[model samples]
Target: MELKQETQTYEMPHLLTYYECDETGHPSMSMLLSMISMASDEHSMALGMGIEKVQATGGTWVVSGYEGQLAEQQPVFGETIILGTRAVAYNRFFAVREFWITDKEHNIEYARIKAIFVFMNLKTRRMESIPAALIEPFRSPIVKRIPRLKRPQKLNENAPIVEKDYRVRYFDLDANHHVNNARYFDWLLDPLGRNFLKTHRLKKFNLQYLQEVRDGEKIDSKVNKLIENQKITCHQISSDNQIDAIAEIEWY
Candidate 1:
């Protein structure tokens, strides 16, 4: 059954857990992303394109990246919050989804997200056109060009940058057999170390996943301080000198 625009959104109750929060007692970026990704999956299942059905299509959904902001009033550990997502739009190879976390009353929103997803063929691991049967339920229109989020700025390779290395852990591998998209946040923020992360809060962030990092791969996460904007930091992850991803993060 196709979902009408009026009912295309899906919401599920979530209880913030101590494990999902950082020393600041706020949700970590990685875990928060996992919440919305889970909500997107739930929304898909409700529309009849659950994991099994999607797998049968011989392709899997891949998150290109996300652009979002955190509100000042964030939910604390143990708070029950609402995680919601709406299948916004799609073209042949890409889909756009919007997500949010809000209070039960929905009078307060903790965060808002926009993400781009593409279908990748299982064996070939190359992008493929989204199957009509798969996307028909979402009731989004197909267009020539999919919408692009505010992309993270590219890293200036010529500039001096601080760097740290991370080994893709077994636990970081999600069902897709790759380093989970959420785990990138861990690597991205960890380079700043505990002091900076605990002292400041993320106000806005934009990320772009140019390549995938698989299990057992060593990634060098680098940070370049913006000369013009001291408050802003630019980051990129490279494997064997090849960039896997780039991002821009701002804090308050």
Candidate 2:
């Protein structure tokens, strides 16, 4: 399949707000995801397929999963950065979106991400085919190509070290009353610590959601660094032992 260059580019100006930073004085993983969401909206608007047009078709784009890698920990409160995004490709049921963050000079890439999106019928609340009119403006090919993202592989439980815990927070709930999907990225990546996080940038990531997290319920996050380029993480909510999500992130 022929991969076409992006027809349009969306540039987003980001002001690092204090509330978005973590204890280490850098943007939190959750906040980074928020910035990506903002950039994705701007990209859609540039293509003339803003939120209204998406909803007019009785469907909306829902992020199925994301993979992000950061080169350095972004600073807090005073940095002005540009978030750029482009629509990469789309099939009947899925679409691929790409994003990058660069300093004001645009010389260095602070972070990069690839995401999978699916359209859902607002009324029926089920996955639906992506609308042609909505995708055509992006001008990316509807090719057979799909990203070869790494999948989470099982790890040895008897290993020398492993970490796991459950989380329950009121703020995790979104307007939809379920946990906002992006919050899971925080839980998935936080275990890597500020040391490893500050030193490496994400090269690739793949995530999958299996269940929903509810308000007031505890969710367990399990993580293991299985190899040099791979890490496996999972989220389980409550005593039912239900796995809500799993993700694999690769770093350089």
Candidate 3:
């Protein structure tokens, strides 16, 4: 495919709010993910591919995984931050996008993340080829070799694991009509408990979503209780004997 209009990057400003922050006064991981996701949505809308437009083709965009790094210093509530994203590349089966959170001046970057997305058939819930209308505007080079994100480490079952169960709630559903991917971070991190979450800062993470988590299903979120001296922890989300997602988090 020949390249066309290529305004690949899109950026917007967001005012941090109290509700998005945790006890430590920084935006929670899940909210951080959500904010970047909003940027991506805005990017698509700017290119005339809104959710309704995309869904009209009988499919929707879904994130398959994310890998990101965070700085020790984070923006606090009441501050204005910049959310930026760009379509990196795409292939017939997948698309890659990069995102960043920074101060308004772009001097202090709080986080840098990348996600792999796939087109899924809404009715059949199966993978599909990327629609040229949905992807061509970004002008990301269509390559046979799409980049792959780092695979998260598998949970060590032999190690001491902390497990918590949660019921999928109606509120968890987003515009895609499934549990929002960002909400999974809440379930994944809550098992770390309050004190630990307050004291530690997440430095890096990789999360892979293997299956869709639907509303009304009972799910288990588990994390290794024994953190490596390296300050790394492994997590898993599962339901009905199947693993739904897995992640590895590195903390400072």
Candidate 4:
């Protein structure tokens, strides 16, 4: 995991608003991802690799997956927190980034995240080698193998499951003109219902984005309960014609 010594980091002050918190009063998983994502974007812009710059190259950074941990004491509404991120490393087609959330005073860190990203040709919708100009700006070394994320296994045929459908709202769109990567969390967790959601808290999580969900698309979010493992649950979200994403979570 060797990377450049001069890893550049950027931080921004963020307030956890009521809408960002779930019924339990903790920042929702999706919202936490969104906050850190904003930090990552800002860091890129500061390094002259901003959204416009990347898009101008005829491609965009696409999140392949994210693996993160939720501390027992999660951030709550109305509290301001420090969101931080830095590019870690990159290979030919993959780049790694890290993110964190801490109290305003920079104490009591609540979450830590590692995500994998790839460059894609927008028109062709195919993977492309990450442009050197993009990676070099972050000062992260171009490594032989970027650290890999935990790959989620496919759901079992006999796994007990429940599902629900959701409509992509206008608000889910982000600067990329696609559904923000974090918005999928609501669909991923909603099938568990309000009762299960309120009683449990996410302790560990992983997600893989297989396809992008655009505005006006409808998704079928399915959850498979792992009877042998009380702490683990698997999810698969599909649009009318394709599987959009798959994820797994551990609750305690």
lDDT of 2 by residue, 1-252 (tens): 012235556777788878887765667767887788878877777667777888899988888777777774455667887788878888898888888888877877888888888888887778999899998888877978677445555434455334556565888876545577778777676666777676665555567765656676666666654445443343222224777777665565
Q: After best superposition, candidate 4 residue 72: deviation in angstroms? A: 0.4
Q: Spell out the clash pairs found in candidate 4.
A: none
Question: How do the residues 1-252 of candidate 4 rate in per-residue lDDT, one tens digit apiece?
Answer: 112236577788888899989889998888888888888877877766777888999999889999988788888899998898888888999999988888988778888889999999989989999888888878877789777889876766486778799999999897678889899999998998887889888988889999989899999998875354478888889997698999888787
- Per residue, candidate 1 scores C-alpha lDDT tens digits across 36-126 of 9988888888877889999998998999889998897888999998998888889888898888899877889999989999999999989
Task: Estimate the TM-score for candidate 4.
Answer: 0.92
The alpha-carbon lDDT assigned to residue 123 of candidate 2 equals: 78
Q: Which stretches of candidate 3 lie over 4 Å from their true place?
A: 1-7, 227-230
Give all candidate RMSDs, comma-separated: 2.3, 4.8, 3.0, 3.1
Which predicted model would earn the best TM-score? Answer: 3
Better of 2 and 3 by TM-score: 3
TM-score of each model, in listed order: 0.94, 0.78, 0.96, 0.92
Clashes per model (N, Cα, C within 3 A): 0, 3, 0, 0
Residue 85, candidate 3: how far off, in angstroms? 0.3
lDDT of 4 at 64: 94
Compared with the true structure, model 3 gives a TM-score of 0.96
- C-alpha-based local distance difference test score of model 3: 0.91
Per-residue lDDT, model 4, residue 144, is 92
lDDT score for candidate 1 against the true structure = 0.85
